[model samples]
Structure formats: structure tokens, C-alpha cells
Target chain A: MSSAVEEKRKHQKAQKKADRDAALAKKAELNMTSLMDIFVNVLIYLLMNYSTSPVDVPQSKEHTLPQSSTKLEVKHTTTIAVTKKIIMVNRKKVCDVVKNTVDPSLKKDKQASSYLITPLFKELKEDVQKQKKIAKYNPSAAFKGEVTIVADQDMSFRLLSEVMYTAGQAEFSKFKFAVVKKGG
Target chain B: MGKKIRQEDATEEINIMPLMNIIMLLIPFLIMSTEFIKIGVINVAAPKIGGGASSSEPKKKDEKPPLNLTVSITEKGLTILTRGKKIPEGCDLKGEATEAKLPTVKKIGDKHNLPVLKQCLQTIKEVFPDERRIIIMAEPEIRYSIIIDVMDHSREGKTADKDMFPEVVLSAGVL
Candidate 1:
């Protein structure tokens, strides 16, 4: 038979260890409800904004396009982006825009007041010739004289007209403006 | 006191393990495939420098004179003109008139009165139902959004069956 004192000591040690283990378990329990709520909300928001579009117009704070309800789909063609500080043809920087106008040094004949952007025109002409050459070689890829203009919403009509006129001079007959489609 | 339950009990009110797994797989997939800003296109006529459309010039005497509908957007407001003459605000487009009042639609509280412009165009559409082409001209300082807004207002009515003008010819401001 075991002594009463020895039995009492053994029971006391077992109870203390059980209590410590219970406290540790309680402390380790994690509440996952709040984390799950946040994730679900974010997922729902992202899902709502999903769309399948082919036109990959680079969007930034300074290069936002005007919104419109036109049902016209964006056709892939030569792209000319007119941002706040620069003008790009087919994602290649051609000239700089200062105060909503092409740089004077980049104008035709280097005239400060001339609207024809010489650098832009030259870049567009090169693209046109390349497209014509490709069309000549391959009957399937014919030159359509189409160009997409992705311009900032607040862009001045003067700059837009200059770009349009310069593009026309470069022999791009069909013109299309890239816009953010609304009313979806 | 926060008590830890015994090991062998139901864990949650609703099991979300499957949902979490699906979300983990979908979030990245959707992020790659989605276009947050839907990009579209609006076709506009290119500005021709020398000469354009001999048919509209009316060289032959028997050829009917073109209506030549044009909307000029200025800092003040939108002005609808046909055949080099302005159509008065809230007035009808006569297509061809010898002497008509000045045609200008005043802005409504620093904004172009688009509804009034649409009403005026509706009256003009009645006269020239077959005419689909219209020229748009904007001043140098005019914002590009205003031009797009005006085009939207002039392009269609409440329904698809009632299209106002789809053929938009952009003028180089001088024309």
C-alpha cells in the first residue's frame, strides 16, 4: 500500500500540470472569422471588376482615356498614345508634349508655331511603310490605313487635332479613339 | 475565462475550407485574366488637308446641295450649324435657309446643355432623315471629354432603333 502523503503529492502535481496545459491551449486558439471575412470581401470586389478585352491601353494617373457609351469594339492597329508629358507611337516614344502642344523643335520645318509634329509624322510614316511592305509580301496581312488614338481625357483639342492631322499626312485614313467603355 | 473545448467536437458553424481552397486558386487566376478598365473604341473621320468628297462639293448643278451639318464646340457652349450658318439655340435645323437667326446653344451652369442640343438635333433629323454624316469642330482650349460627351449625346437616342448620327467627321477646328 502507498503512503497517504506520497499519494496526495502525486495528485497535486497532476492537477497543476493539467491546469497549465488548459491555459496554453486557450491562449493558442486563433479566431479565423475576421480574416475570412476580409478575404471574401476582397474576392467579391475583384470578381466584379473582371473583363475580357483585347486592347491593352496602358493606364496611369496622367493617361486616363475619356469614357463613352459607344458599342464599337477596339480593333487592333497602330496605336498612338498621347499622355500628359509625352506622345508615343506603337508604345515607342517619338516626341515630347509641353503645355498640351508638341515641342517646337519637333514640329515640321522646326517652326515653333507649326502644328505638324515632324517626329511623330516621321515615326508614323515609317510604321506605314513597314505595314505596306508587309502587305505587299503577304496577301493576308493587308494595310488598312487604321490607327487607334489613346489620348488623355483632359487633353487639349489642339494637340488632338495636330496628332490627327499629322497621322492623316502619314497616310492613315481610318481613325479610332480609345475610350473606357461604360454602361456595362 | 476563455476555456478550450475538448478535442473531438464540431469546429465551426459553417465549414469554409473548400471555399478557401477555391478562392486561393481563383484570386490569382482572375487577377491575370481581368481588365479592370474596359477599353473600347470610337471611330472618327480623319481631317483631310487638300480636298475631300467631291460629291459633297456639288460641282454639277443638278446635284442637291449637301446639308453639311456641323457642331462647333466652343468655351461658351455647342453651336449647331448647317451649310455655313448657325442654328439658333432651341431652334430647328432648316437644312437650307437664306437668313436665319444665330444658332447657339448656351451652357447650363458651366456645362453644355446636352439635352437641349439633343432636342434641337431631333428636329433636324426629321428634315434630313437619310443624312448620317455630321462634322464636329472644337476650339483649341476645349477639353477632349466635352467632344466625346457631345458625340455620345448626338450618336443615339434612348433606344438603338432611334440612331441620330453614327458617322462622325472630325473637323480640324478651322474647317
Candidate 2:
């Protein structure tokens, strides 16, 4: 009788071990099919929207760009932004544009002969010199003298022309106006 | 032989678990780095300084000079001038023509006339398909934003689905 009781206890122990082993195996098997499906969808969406162009101008509250239906792609270049009250180059304030006109103090040349703003011209000239020096060492990269202007819509053409003229004097001949894409 | 066959089958099953792990990490990285705002550009050439003639060809006595399209922005509305002559009564945006000069007070809803100016430009574009240059004249008090909007309309005829005048020359309104 004791032998039979021992055999029955051993059988119970084996069954409990089997049950625990089965539970662990079930827990270890992770179904990654759903997770993979989600990842693939997200990857495709991001890849579709990815832009190969290098220029990425950050928009701010003070300087809102005008909307347009142009399809020209913006390339990476030096940026000159004209806000309601100030003019900036690469996020640095070069001078002030007050009430649709460049500040009188900043004007070096008379309005009739030249529209080049003094402080802006000096700053842009330095930037061009620095870029040219960098291009000398890096043979693969060349300076294109390209610049983008981001000006507030409410500002006058006088300010825009002054900024463009100053940039031209600084050896920046190519001009591009940064605008928000209309519709989508 | 049976054990060898089983080993070959196991090797044939590609271990994609590592690839899946890498993809999972890349998705979040790309999502964070992606930019939302789409930026575009309008290429513009600087205005020429002097009025020197480019062509050396001798002028004919009866040959009419080429039409120079100029859109002047005033306080009342837009005035479309072609070769110094105003086109017609339809180009005016204030519902009536006002001969107001510069430093005139900008009225509300004055920008709504841009579409009318665009229509006039479209007709001119149909006549001269190759003409891509336009002179934009604005008052000193005119906002920069309005000038941009005018350029946007004059640069391309959106309704006509054609390039009207992409070259814009900025000038002060003298009339």
C-alpha cells in the first residue's frame, strides 16, 4: 500500500511540472506580426514625406511668409529674413526696418544713388568672405552666392529691394524668395 | 541523413528577429527628425539699375514698341498700365476709379482687387505667351505683404494654368 501511495505522489508531481513547463513556453512565444505591421506602416509614411532638399527654414511668429503656387524647390543657402520691425541674417539681427522703410541711420548711401543699407552690407560681406574661404579648402562644396529672403507680407517693396541690393553688393547675385506653399 | 536534412531546413529559415529589432528602432528616429512645414521658393533677378538699351538694332519709324506691362498698387485699388496707357475701366478694384496719389490711406478689403488684376494679366498673357517680365509699382505706404501677394498673382496665372510673368521688377508708384 505504501508503494502505491508513493507512485501516486510521483505521478502528481510530474503532472504539476508539465503544467508549469507548458505555461512558461506559452509566455515565451511573443507574437510580433502585429507589431511589425505597425512599424512597416509608420516607416512608409515617414519615407514618403521625407524631403531630400537641404534647406529647412524655421518659421516664426514675427515673420510669416506669404503663400504662393510656385513649384520651385528651396535649396540650402544663406537666409535673410525681414520681420515687421527688424532684418535678420541667419537668425542674427543686422538692422531695423521701421514702418516699411529702412531706418535712416542705417542708410549709408543716398536713396537716389544707391539703396544699400550700411550695416547689412557689412554683415553680408563678412559672411561671403567666410563662405569663400571655407569653399577653398572643401573642393567638393562650392559657394553659389545664393541667398533666400523671408520677409513679412505687410512690409513694403522698398525694404525688400534694399536688402536685395545690399546682398548683391556683398557678392550674392542669386536671389530666392522663401514662401509657404499654397494649398498643400 | 535525416539529421543532416533537418539541419539544412533550420538554416534555410532566415533569422529576421534582428532585422525587426533594428526597424523598430529606426521608425521612432525618423518620425522625430521629420519636418512638417513644406517650404518653397520663387526665383527673382535683381532690378537693372540703368535704362540703357540692350539691343543695338536700328529702330523702325512705324514699328510699335513692345508692350511693357506694369501693375501699379494705389490706395484705391490696382491700376494696370501697359506702355503708359491704362487698359480699361474693368481693371480698377475700388468699383470706381480714384486718382488718389501716394501716402494715401490703405482701405480695408483693398487686397480683394488682386484677383481682378490677375484676370487682366491673364488676358495679356494669352496675347503674349512669351512675355515673362512684369514691373510691380507700389506706394511707399503699401505693406510688404500686399506686394508679395501681387507678385504671387502676377508671377503665375493660377486660373489660366500658365506662366504669365515670372520676372518681377520692383518700383515705386509715380502716378
Candidate 1: tens digits of C-alpha lDDT, residues A1-184: 5689889999999999999999999989766678678778878877887765656777898898999988888887999999998999999999888879777778888886677898888899999899989999998998877899999998998888888888887888778999998976
lDDT by residue for model 2 (A10-95), tens: 99999999999999999997777777788888898888777665665556776778887778888878888888888888889888
- The candidate that achieves the highest TM-score relative to the unseen native structure: 1
* Clashing residue pairs for model 1: B87-B103, B88-B103
* Residue B166 of model 2, lDDT score: 84
lDDT for B74 (candidate 2): 73
**Cα-based RMSD of candidate 2:** 6.3
Candidate 2's residue-wise lDDT over B11-82, tens digit each?
664566897989978877887667676778888755544112221235446455657778777777676767
Clash list (residue pairs), candidate 2: A153-B144, A153-B145, A154-B144, A154-B145, A155-B144, A156-B144
Question: What TM-score does chain B get in every candidate?
Answer: 0.71, 0.63
Model 1 DockQ class: acceptable
Task: Please provide, for model 1 over B62-174, each residue's C-alpha lDDT reduced to its tens digit, 9 standing for 90 to 100.
Answer: 36787788998987777888877877655755444323443367787789998888888877888788777788988888888999998888898657777788888888664
lDDT of 1 at A85: 89
